[model samples]
Target: MSTLRPGRRFRTALRLAGIAAAFAAPPLAAGAVHFSRIAPLTGYAPAPAFDAPDIDVPFDPGKRTAVVVMSNTGTELTDFLAPYEVLAATGAFNVLAVAPEARITPLGAGLDIVPHLSFAGYDARIGADPDVLVVPFINDWRGAANRPVVAWIKAHAGPGTTLLTICGGAVTLAETGLLDGRRATTYWDFFAWVPRAYPAVQWVQGQRFVDDGNIVSSAGIANGIPATLHVVEKILGKAVALETARKVGYAPVAQLADPRFTLGMSPLPAVLLANAFRFDKTEMGVVLHDGVGEIDLAAVLDTYPRSGTTLTRLVADTRRVVRSRHGLFLVPRWDFASAPRLDRVVVPGARGALDDAPLAAWARDRHGVGVTYLRGDLGAPLAADRFPFDLTLADLARGESAAVARWSARGLEYTPEDPAVLAGAGWPIGIVVWPMALGLLGVALGTLGVRAVRTRA
Candidate 1:
């Protein structure tokens, strides 16, 4: 008998591995998947009436101080930005995005933010506890890296400060033990894990937010919008909160959430896995500039990359950091003069109309890339619901595939009411089917080639 050549053996192994990978990808993407034995508990809990304590330390008397904490490791994009932007829009508070350090804090999905002040810097600058402290989901909440952040939160949990946690941020706050025995809510997906991890806190569901006096916790992602608006209503008054909601184009805050947010077996895992294995990815550039709306920016930065078919890079005229409308500092990944070739460019909503003529001219003239405005202009809301996530889904539906948009929404734990958003589009069966088909073909061809060689031998 003759031995198979090294090259032939390697090729055969490669073909077999490819076939195995096609079958293995989805489960790998799902990541130690487990199903809940019982349906998630759901119900609404009203915000209790409680008087906010006056600030004990000295602060600017002219405006109330609000600090949105950032974790240098990784923070959720919408979780951090929505509350910061909404609160800043009220103009009742001097909002600041403070972090554990002054480094570039990377947000989940993609995008880097520079915190306005370090924890010590905040101490020196304000020298007082904040009137409102917003905590977004930190990627390393339980790890040692998060210890300093937890410590800072504990130090700042003053009698006057109202602690607000967005999404899994409840877990981060729970780490500080302040949420012990408090009625709190978090992202619906965490229904299984959060309670098991921290049984001390009373976790509530079916509510957009639960306001247990000083500690307020909200449901996942976009739910932060209504929860922040609720905080506004509590502090600033209903009229002011209503105006803020109107400006953002979001509806009035509803006490009861649609209780349908529980998790189960979804096509999302498979869709995401297929997209992840895709070779061709669109290189997209998001224009960054001074006074850009955080909500609009977050919507674009956070949403597009989730499709798993796009990679986003921040583009600006200069590489220098630009201050967002609400005062959060964002670092640009590329300057127009030196940016690489891009497939497309996105302009997020801003406080006012940005003169994008130069950027547009550069993108078109240099790389033949077209620019799409997330919001037509500052006057119009990004979407009917005014949710950044919705704007992203709409953009994906129009620019990519409606199927991709729906799949992205499912992954993000959102359900759209309007069927038309995903209408006329079906799953990209090609992503999975074609790969598996090709792998099987390769395997059969390899087997035939091996059998022919053996016969000759």
Candidate 2:
């Protein structure tokens, strides 16, 4: 196997890291993976092709832990990023994304991630032995026989390096045969499948995390936060882990517990900070396109993030780039040809909304497609057209009587923030999403109701 060359993904990560180095940041006790929103591509023209400027900068090297996050084309966005952010926040680890090759690795949420080093380049650049190896199961976990990831894990797990897998990540690690006799747990949704898939491993459920000696495995998406925090505590210490938790507004758990049963109502502002607690969520897709128009994605996605809902970006262009009209450059994590299973897909409108046959067809074919228009005065036709969008973000954020009724009249089965779909904290406490049957009754009764949970208690 060869290492990463000074190719596109390599140079992009290096250049982005260069820009992050310029910011004023406090030095850590050891090497750390610093993060920042990458600067908009330089000298970017209306054309797709562009050149990167030569830059001279390196990552900080004072952090104690060397954390390597492995990603391929379809790793869960929350699985990789949540751990990266949590570990990096502690200023205790030099976290990096490593791949079999240095290329644009597509991850969920319509975002592309650049691997800092290839597995073959690890010893030369980072080191032969890292403090920790973090693995998370991605969308395309099956079918690849004895992939490089398995080979790498087989070569690396031992004394001086803690090996960990998050959610479905354990499944990938199991294929390596290290967990054959070891006890483990995975996302509860796959409780039955994993045991059947990897019969040698002792697969348990209900535990947020399971630690059998050197290997630590987490239950599901948000569940990794606590398990990773525990690893932080082991290496860095209780104070640092606690501080990291506090600073991030997360309360750390010391033991394994299912997130589904621990659902807590939260405030409106804090909704953005909490993770969906479900352990059985099906992944969803948020499509990104060229010159994509804004639908306040962050604003509209307020209810989905920090939750168990696994939302990933799916793009279908050869250039493999999706830029918002507002100038935010978004790299798609999955192109259409390789896009994985998405229970739902949300498409924000662009000027060509009416003309994109593929986009319309894709959404129409999929279950629970969502559409929201950021550009106002799109005329009633655009608003009324059933191009797969049943309601606006406004109807989701604040349900209006008429709009809700209109949707009820259509008998559309999809409902935003449906607990059955995803129990995202975005829905307030005490709220009930009227089912289609009840909606029909509501239309006949000429009366309506509202219920959304509020306050944490």
Best of the candidates, TM-score: 1
User: Residue 132 CA error for candidate 1 (Å)?
Assistant: 1.0
Alpha-carbon runs more than 4 Å astray in model 2: 1-62, 252-457
- Give me the candidate number with maximum lDDT: 1
**TM-scores, in order shown?**
0.81, 0.51
Candidate models: Cα lDDT each: 0.72, 0.52
Tens-place lDDT digits, model 1, residues 1-457: 6498989999989877866765555434332231110101000111112222221233356999999998877788889988998898988898888888776667754467767788998998887899999999887688887899999999998999999999889999999999999999998779888889999999998777888999888888777888888888888888898889877766534432333245334556445544544445577788888888888887776666766667776778977767777666777757888777888887786324477678778889988976777676321334533555666777676655676776667655555545554443455565666556555665666667768999999
Off by over 4 Å in 1: 1-60, 255-265, 350-352, 377-387, 415-417, 449-457
lDDT of 2 at 216: 86
For model 2, how does the per-residue alpha-carbon lDDT over 146-258 read when each residue is reduced to its tens digit? 28777777787758888889888899888889899998888755876777889999997766678887888887665676788877877888888888766543543434233
